[model samples]
Target: MTAEDLSTGHTAIGSDPALDSKIKNYYTPARIIGTDYTYKHKIVWKNAIGFLILHLLALWGLFIFFTGGVGIKTALWAFFILFISSEGITIGAHRLYSHKSFTATPLLRGILLTLQTIAGQNSMYIWCRDHRLHHRYSDTDADPHNAKRGFFFSHIGWLMSKKHPYVIELGKRIDMSDLEADWMVMFQKKYYYPLYALFALFIPVWVPVQYFGESFKNSLLVCYFFRYLFQVNGTWLVNSAAHLFGTRPYDQNLQPVESWFVSWLSFGEGWHNYHHTFPWDYKAAELSMHFNVSAIIIRWLEKIGLAYNLKTASTEMVAKRIIRTGDGTHYALGNDDAKARVTAIGPLHPFNPSYTTKYEAPGANLNDQGLPLFHEMDVINVNNKNIKRNFTKA
Candidate 1:
């Protein structure tokens, strides 16, 4: 296949930021093409240049500082900043805002938003808008970072080009009504640039220099630029590495897979198969949160009354999925032959009687409209009748 075919077969044309100001009028008629929905090529030079600059800065920082005698303190600061910034994307942008897996208190929300700014991804509003669309239309042309488009394209090239028209077209259909209602989310979008520079750039550099007497040059390179680069790459891995390199356990029909290496970098978001299978689950993985620092933080927030209404898939539901749609690549679970036969995803989670009773009555998990509760990633196929509900052993 050619590069464009390898890169998800998407086309962009006639770049203009003005069209993006309002979703309804977003489409430019000139950009629209044949019945198959293809368009000509158009690159967004600003985003392309921005990405180039970031890469150059990261390389310069690594070469000059590491080879030219940077202090140990500065290196540690870079490491610490990477972890915190990754959490800002994984927890704040992905789990909290995009999935709504759990409710956060205003205090916790404020903290996450501040950390998100420090992470230097865009405001949560804009981030979630694209993310929700990606999950809903994954692997298709509508997906902003569709993995079928190849690694480099999905990883960073999507941002470097003008969005495919289908992105704006199908993207506008996603009900952003909920997002429009949140003043805090809106406030961040309104003042995103200023906040990003202050929180993401200034504070990181300021902290090491002010507290530990580090040189501004070393602090800027190690703490700010390099740290930002690390977090951005980690975030990109969810769309690229997790989808391309890992095993698909939850649903082989979907392209997303569970990648341990990516989970380590992104703070627990690399369980792509489980995540795509059960997007409403706060933990994202079927197993424990041991590898998922984001889930652990959410639990801690729950204990301190900063989070509530944490959602998780029933043991029966996950087990059923493993047996049916799973690619047979997960961990074994339980004494039951039926569950154990297909437990190829992760460590088995024991079923909770009370939790099961609360949400598993006939049509229990359905929404008010009698449709299954759908998140951006999950697609429920409830036609199978031989679902084994027992998950007591592992």
Candidate 2:
């Protein structure tokens, strides 16, 4: 299971692991916020200044809304954008693209690409790469925004700072061939900057001014800045508040927790405890899709033949997983009746689980090789062409 993770198909593989150690020591380690992980956090003045300006503009947008500067239609438009933009990331980048929880047709992929382009997050390829890295090296120095670095760092601070060298080093090792193989993914990656400017900034601002007779200033401030700010923060909440707060019903050893508030805010990604437990589940959460807007939208797509091959962690697996590793916060924590309905599933190999396929989750039992659970992430059958674009990156 110590088989090394493949590269992004961008960088050459380094023979010496010492290169990671070399980068680690060269930088002055910062404060301990992410448990044991610490790294130099050099501020990027431009990103910091840009964010500050955006925050100020968003506040002005809010102030103007109260003073009749913007029409109700403009405000509603922003809200609508929020929903679709968030959907692109949750269902498109995270689930469909990153996890391979479901398959979407080329038409559906184009729609998701457009929506995600509006979101102004990085291209789907990069987004999935970082997401995979986050799962592969959760809570470690290699994690892009290690929650151990505290709420602010995990939330927004990581955006305004240079990536920790370890992040760059480990990031190169994350395989991205699957994403590269997708024509839609690479197309977006190639034109991401232009698409971001056109959809995320220009169009959002221009539409209100052109159609609604909203002032150019109001449209720019509210439709572009505030709407962007809101969606970005909502996404960050899943990274920050979801981890810092909530109960870890699935696995106490992990930092991610189940935060209902986060789910509501992030467009249905708040079920951190269950999500970290079973990343392959298309639902993300173990519970019903009462508030999961992303799950609901994905289901709607499935109905229309836009998405299929949806994967899930069955009730049996979830029930048994809770009994084996839960931190006693699960609803069925002490419900022996529920636990008795599902038998425990032992690991079949040091690598694969008898109950799960393709992707291995966070709480799977450690192997005889004494490798961490993350190592099993790369233990999948790489030769499977059917899942060439599987979200389980190297």
Candidate 3:
């Protein structure tokens, strides 16, 4: 379909009138109803096989001791990999690359890229492309991982399923010029597969054996397989658990929520409600930094001159958003006194350099047709333009 057809919600497209009519009957660009005639189980074989292997390896973790006990050193190394690699997604992919919440120096950017590669998530370019689509379409059929599809589908099923046609079609609307222009992002995408094997697969197993004198079998099963599985599920929880449960103080209209349990697992990316509400916020939360390691690391980078131009919603901006759309689950939602207290909270830290003198409240912008665009749609388009300008300046 042409951009005009999609914008007008016209079901028909293409040059041939007969073919367009047949296609229109099969698919409607309006909205995805899982029960629609077009809906079908499109299995992604490679992802299915990979996921099956990972799950079996996770089960093997139970019998790891009986197989051959993993040493304390090996287990510790596995845990370390788990945390850092997961942060690579939460900090590198989500906060930095996808949202452009903070700018990183070349050296720091390289380190984050390395860690993200080791995490085994796709290259930053691919991850950001899918992520922007997710935010733009949200619970609609076009969302790459639409939560409305159900917990399992939203969590990992989308990865193992054939991507919906709308996902591919609408994804093209997202301007990726910024990501494409980045030398580092493009380089990573160009060499993603080989780099993934070298960093994610080989290094994890090789380290325990070469440095810790671990048996190859034990290292492969425990440090490499089990650790990789843990990190994958932890990241998945932010998409599943965070979306389906928890409090929605920021915006009840959005499906995403805040879950402390998910926060701990995701290394502080559990503030989903606020994240969907204010995607540009560096912290991804309106309140405490206690659970947000991503924000902390960005702050530290700012201090060392490795990160800059960190974006965050101000107290007034956050308060206005909550008061307008909050579900009253937040303590600061109702009373004037409570709201004041929330606003009174200081910057992330005393020395934090990421502060904004003016706050721009998140909202929808109108299309040429005069209807307001969805917040996510506005975000993707607007952010791309801003990042492109920044890239040119840099």
List the global CA lDDT of all models: 0.69, 0.72, 0.72
Error of 2 at 94 (Å): 0.6
Please name the candidate that would achieve the greatest TM-score relative to the true structure. 2
Per-candidate clashes, comma-separated: 7, 4, 0
List TM-score per model, in order. Answer: 0.75, 0.78, 0.77
Give lDDT: candidate 1, residue 310.
Answer: 75
Clashing pairs in 1: 7-149, 8-149, 330-344, 330-345, 331-344, 331-345, 334-394
**Candidate 3 residue pairs in backbone clash:** none
lDDT of 1 by residue, 25-112 (tens): 4332333211132443377899899889988888778785668546677677778877877887888888888877777888888888
| Tens-digit lDDT string for candidate 3 (1-394) | 6777755647543367886676665564344322233576598899899899888987686468446578888888888888889888988998888878778888988989989998988899888888877676666666777776778988899999988887777677776888888898899999999999998889888998999898998888887788888898888888887777565677877777777778767877888889888887678776656777877877788889898877666566677888888765565555544333322125522122221111122232212121112232222221233322222110
Comparing 2 and 3 on TM-score, the stronger one = 2
Predicted structure 2, TM vs. truth: 0.78
